[model samples]
Target: MTAKAERMASLPSSLPPFGVGRLKAAALFDISPSLFDRLVESRQLPQPRLLGGRLVWDVSELGDAWRSLPHRLEDIDGFTTTGNPWDE
Candidate 1:
């Protein structure tokens, strides 16, 4: 194989394409398609954009939305729970 072919073969194959369909978008988030739809409806995720007459999710937008999701308090650093509220 030529050097260019070798370099191309060495590139990561699992990287997502620029834009993806509904199913692919769901798979990217590791969630069911229905749940993906619910998230979209709830405005937790951005709506897909029209590309070449096809509705497709932009991977960068998905990434931004994922980063914007709320994180649990426990997941945050310097967080501590005093007493269990359930005990009150």
Candidate 2:
């Protein structure tokens, strides 16, 4: 299996692959629910699915998204100011 899949499979059952809400995601990131939606809209975070009007995301995707934050910000900064941060 892929690394993400393997890691996801090993997470505690309390956090399954999907079906998470803004409240739970906020708790995971220690942010407010409203802020979480803003982050999502800004593309600073992953966009979860909607189930019956409830926003949800897989724990695995959330974990990956969390880990990618720094990289994403770096890329944005590089693109905006340097044309390419890794162009050294």
Candidate 3:
């Protein structure tokens, strides 16, 4: 293989499948941390696990939740254009 191809092959396939703290989770959804808190409180999102004295949401679980969201925001109960990543 060419040098570029070999280098690409040596890179990791994807990010590690692990838990993320609150800010990271919110950043993933492109929502404010406060909104993330609300989602958790309202049960719109799964409760994060408390690990080693820190709260963390499973990355895979978060990805699954994102995939499960309604294709159209209108279908969601209180989805708004405000703070929406799609709007950016």
Top candidate by lDDT:
3
lDDT tens digits, residues 1-88, model 2?
A: 9996898789997865565777888788999989988998998888888777766887788888898766433656455534555876
* TM-score to native of every candidate shown: 0.63, 0.56, 0.65
Q: Which regions of candidate 2 fall more than 4 Å away from where they truly are?
A: 1-17, 71-88
Worst 10 residues of 2 by lDDT: 72-81
- The residue ranges of model 3 lying beyond 4 angstroms of the native Cα positions read 1-13, 73-88
Which is the better candidate, 1 or 2, if ranked by TM-score?
Answer: 1
> If both were scored by TM-score, which would come out higher, candidate 2 or candidate 3?
3
Candidate order by lDDT, decreasing, is 3, 1, 2
lDDT of each: 0.84, 0.77, 0.85
Which has the greatest TM-score?
Answer: 3
- Residue-level lDDT of model 1, residues 1-88, one tens digit each, is 9996896588788864677899989998999999999999998898999988988999999999888765654533454444558757
Off by over 4 Å in 1: 1-16, 74-88
| Superposition error at 57 for model 3 (Å) | 0.5
Winner on lDDT (1 vs 3): 3
